[model samples]
Target: MDWQQILTNVAGEIIAPTTAAYALAAIGLNVHFGMTGLLNFGQAGFMLLGAYGYAIASIAGWPVWAAVLVALACAVVFALILGIPTLKLRGDYLAIVTIAAAEIIRMIGRSTSMTEVTGGNAGLAGDGFKGSFQELSPLPDGNFAIGPWSYSMNLSNSWWVRIVGWALVALACFLVWRWMNSPWGRVLKGIREDEDAVRSLGKNVYAYKMQALVLGGAIGAIAGIVYALPRAVQPDSMGRPMTFYVWTILLLGGAATVFGPVLGSILLWTTLMLVKTVLRDVIPATVLRSEQIEMLGWVLVGVTLMLLVIFRPQGILGDRKELAIDVR
Candidate 1:
C-alpha cells in the first residue's frame, strides 16, 4: 500500500468542496433535529430544488445572483409546503412525509417531461454560470504541492469552485453559530425541549417551527449549489443516500454543537478516502474490483453509524441532556 498516496487522498477530501457542502447540509440538519427537534428527512429535496433552480435560471438567461435568489425562494416554498401540515404532527410522521417528498422531487427531476427544463435524467450542464466564480481565483494556473501530494489548481476548473464553496461554508457556519446564540435561538431550544411549555410561555411554536424549517432548508439549498459546483446537476446525485450521508455527518459530529457538522464532514470524508486508498493499494486488482472497494467503503459507513447510534447516540460533541426527545 502506498501510504503517502492514501494520506494525500484523505487530506484532499478533508479540504474538498464536497466536504464543505456536506458540512453545511449537516449543520442545517443539526438545527432541525438537534436544536428544534424537527424531523426533516427531505433535506435532499431542498438540495435538488436549489440545484435545479440555479441550473434552470442560468439556462433561462438569469444572472448568477438572480439564480441564487430563485434557488433560495424554491427552498422557502418547499419548506412551507412540507412544514405546514407535517410540522404540526409528531414523530415519525414528519420523517415519513419528508422522505416521501424528497423521493417525489427526485423522481420529478428525473422525469422525461421536465427534461427540457431540468435536463431530466441526463443532468444539466453549467452554461458559463461558473465563469464569474472562476474569475475570482487568486492562485496561479498550475499544480501546487506541499509534499508527496500535489494538485493542479487549474485542472478541471475545480480550484475556483473549492475556493468559493469553502468560503460559503465558512460563512454559513458563522451565521449558524451567531443564530444559535441569539434569543431566537433560545426559543428554538425551548421548543425542542417542550413545545407545550413554549406555547404556555406565549411563544408561537408553529411560527418558530416554520422559521426553523425555512432556515434549515435554505442552508441545505446552499449545500446543494455547492455540491453541484464541481459537476453537473444530476437528479441521481440528490437521492436518498445524499440525505442519509448528511444525517450521518450530523450525528457523527455532535448535532447541537456549532462546529460538529464541519468536523463530522471532515472525518467522514477522510475515512471514506482512506478506506478507498488502502483497499485499492492492498487488494490486488485480480482479487477485488474497484466496484467492490466502493461497496466496502459504504459498508464501513453503515457500520460506523450503527455503532455511533448504539454506543454514543449523543455524537462526539453532543450533550446527553440535549438529546432528550419525546418521540412518543
Candidate 2:
C-alpha cells in the first residue's frame, strides 16, 4: 500500500471542491433540519434546478452573471412552490413531498422529451459558457505546487472551482451565523424546539418555516451549480444518494451549528477517500475484488455513522441539549 498517496488523497479532499459542494448543500440542510426543524428530503431537487438552470442559461447564450441569477431564481421559485403547499402540514408530509419532488426533478432531467434542453440522462455541458468566467482568473495560467499537491490555472482548472466553492461556503456560513444569531433566528430555534410555543408567542410559524426553506433551497442551488461546473450536469449526480450524503455531512459535523456543515463535509470526504484508497491497496484481489473493496469502504462509512448515532447522536459539534432530531 502506498501510504503516502493515501495520505495525500485524504489531505487534499479536506478542501476539495467536491467537499465544498457537499458542505454547501449540508449548510442548507442544517438550516432546514438542524435550526428550523424542517424535514426537507428534496434538497437534491434544488441542486438539480440550479445545475440545469445555469447550464441551460449558459448554453442559451446568457452571460455568467445572468446564468447565476437565473439559477438562484429557479431555486427560490421551487422553494415557494414546495413550501406554499406543504409547510402547513406536518413534518412527515414535507419530508415525503421533498423526497418525491427530488426524484421527480431527476426523472425530468432524464426524460427523453426534455433531452434537447436538459440533455436527458447525459446532461448539459457548459463548454463555451464558462469562457467569460475564466477570463477573470486572478492567478496566472500555470501549474503551481503547494507542498505535496499541485494546482493549475489551465482552461479546465479546478483552482477556479475551489476558489469559488470555498468562497461560497464561507459566505453562506457567515450569512447563516448572522441569521441564527439574530432575534429571527432565535424564533427559528423556538420553532424547532416547539412550534406550538412559538405560535403562542404570536410568531407566524408558517412564515418562518417558508423563509427557512427558501433560504436553504437557494444555498442548495448554489451547491448544485458548484458541482455541475466541474463537468456536465448529469441527472444521476443529484439523486437520492446525494441527498443522503448531504444529510450525512450535516450529521457528522453537528447539525444546527454554524460551522458544522463545513467541518463535517471535510471530515466525511477525507475519511471516505482515505479508507477507500487504503482498503484497495491492502485487500488482496484474490479474496475480494476492487469493486468489493470499494463497497466495503462504504459499508465502513455506514458503520461509522451508526456508531455516531448510537454513542453521540448530537454529532461532533452538536450539544446534547440542542439535539432535536425530531422535526415535530
Candidate 3:
C-alpha cells in the first residue's frame, strides 16, 4: 500500500471544495437542530432549491448577484412554506414532514414535466451555470499550489471557489457566533430547552422558530450553491443522502458550538477519503470490487458514527447539557 499517497489524498480532502460545502451545510443544520432545536429533516430541500434557483437564473441571463439572490429567496420561501403549519408540530411529526417535503422537492425536480427548466434527471449542466461564478474570479489564469496541493485559480474546483466557499463558512460562523450570544440567541436557547418556558416569558415561540428556519435555510441554500459550483445541480445527488451527510457532520462535530461543524466536516471527509483510498490500495480486487470498496467506506462511516454516539453522545465539542441530540 502506498501510505504516502493515501495520506496526501486524505490531506487534500481537508480543504476540498466539497468539504467546505459540507461544512457550511452542517453549520446551517447546526442553526436548525443545534441552536433552535427544530427537527428539520428536509434541509436538502433548501439546498436543492438554492442550487436549482441559482442555476436556472444564471442560465436565463442573470448576473451572479441576481442568481444568488434568487437562490436565497427560494430558500426563504421554502422555509416559510415548510415552517408555517409544520412548525406547530412536535417531534416525530415535524421530522416526518420535513423529510417528506425534501423528497417531494427532489421528485419534482427530476420529473419529466420540469425537463425544460430543471433539465429533469440530468439537471443543469455545470458548464452552463458555472461560467458566471467563474467569471467573477479576479485571479490571473494559472495554477496556484500551496504545500502538496494545487488547483487552477479560476476554473471549476479552483482556488476561487475554495476562497469564496471557505469565506462563506467563516462568515456564517461569525454570524452564528454573534446570534448565539445576543438576546435573540438566548430566546433561541430557551426555545431549544423549553418552548413553554420561553412562551411564559411572552416570547413568540413560533415567530422565533420561523426566523431560525429562514436563516438556517438561507445558509443551507448558499451551501447548495457552493456544492454546485464545481459540479452540476443534480436533484438526486442533493437529495436525502446529502441531508443525512450534513446531519452526520453536525452530530460528529458537536452541534451548538461555533467551529463544530467545520471540524466535523474536515474530519468526516478526511476519514472517508483515507478509508476509501486505503481500501483500494490494500484490498485485492478479487476480494472486493471497486463498488464494494465504496460501499464499505460508507459502512465504516456509519460504524464510526455509532461508536461516537455511544462513547460521546454530546460529540467532540458539545457539552452534555447543551447537547442537541436528545432534544425534547
Candidate 4:
C-alpha cells in the first residue's frame, strides 16, 4: 500500500463535509445535554426524520425550500412526541426512552413494509433532490489543487454538497453561539443547574425544556440534511453508533462551549484518520487483516472514552462547573 496515498485519503475525510455535519449535530446535543441538562439519546431519530422528510418531499416534486421546511417540521413533531411524556420525567428515563425510540425509528425505516416509501434496507436515491442545491455551486467545473491535496471541482459530486454543507454548519454554529449567550440561554443554564429553582423563580421550566428539545432537534435535522446530501439516504446511517459519535464529539470539544463541537469534530476525525493511516502503514500486513484494523480503531475509541471519563470528564473545552448537573 502507498503510505502517501493512505495519508491523503485520510486527510480528505478529516476535512470532508461529513465532519462538519457531525459537528453540527453535536452542537445540537450540546444544547440539549450540556446547557439544558436534557438527556436526549435519540438524536439519531431526529436526523433520520430530517433526511427522509427532505428526500420524500423532493421525490414528490416539492421545491427545495419546501422540502427543507418539511424536514424542520418533522423534527419539531419528533421533539413533541419524545418530549411530551418524558420531559417531565427524570434523567435516566428520558435517556432510555429516547434511545429506544431512535432505534425503533431506524428499524421501522429498514422494514420491508415501508420499502416503497423509505426504500427499506436498500436506501433511497437523491437524483433530483440535490439538483437544485448543486446548481448553486459557485466554483467553476474543473480541478483545484492546494499543496499535496487536490480535489475535483465537479467530478465527485462533493463540490455542491460541501458548499451547502459547510454553509449550513456555519449557520448552525452562529445561531447556537448567539442563542447560548442570550437570556433564553441563561435560563437553559439555570435549568441545567437547578430546574426546581428556576421554577420557584417564576420561570416555566417545562416550556423551556420543550423549547430546547425543539431547537436542538431542529439542529440535528439540519445535520441529517447535510450528512445525506453527499450520498444516498440509508436507514443505517442514523444508527445508534451515530448518536454515540455525536456524543463523543460533544464531550471532546467541551460540551458547553460555543465552538467546542466544531473543534472537537475536527480534532476527533483528524486523529482517527491519522491513527488509521499510520497503523495501516506500520502494522505488518501479514499479521493483521484489514477487518482487524477496523476493529482495532473502535477498540481504541472505547479505551479513549474510558480514559476521558476517568480523567478529564469536562472534555477539552468544557468547564467543570458546566458539567455540574444534578442528574440524581
Every model's TM-score: 0.94, 0.96, 0.98, 0.93
Model 3 Cα lDDT, one tens digit per residue, 8-52:
889989878999999998999999989989888998999999999
Question: Candidate 3 regions off by >4 Å?
Answer: 324-328
For each candidate, how many residue pairs have backbone atoms clashing (under 3 Å)? 0, 0, 0, 1
Sort the candidates on TM-score, descending order.
3, 2, 1, 4
lDDT of 2: 0.88
In the range 187-285, model 4's lDDT, one tens digit per residue, is 999999889999999999999999999999999998988888877789998999999999988888888888889888887787777777777777988
User: What do the candidate models score in CA lDDT, each in turn?
Assistant: 0.85, 0.88, 0.92, 0.84
The top-ranked prediction according to TM-score is: 3
Better of 1 and 2 by TM-score: 2
Clashing residue pairs found in predicted model 1: none
Candidate 2 vs. true structure, TM-score: 0.96
lDDT by residue (25-142, candidate 2, tens digit) is 9999998988899989999999999988888888888888899999999999999989998998776887899999899999999999999989998887667456656776787887
Predicted model with the maximum lDDT: 3
Better of 1 and 3 by lDDT: 3
Model 3 has a clash total of 0
Worst 10 residues of 4 by lDDT: 152-161
Off by over 4 Å in 4: 1-7, 154-157, 325-328
Candidate scoring better on TM-score of 2 and 4: 2
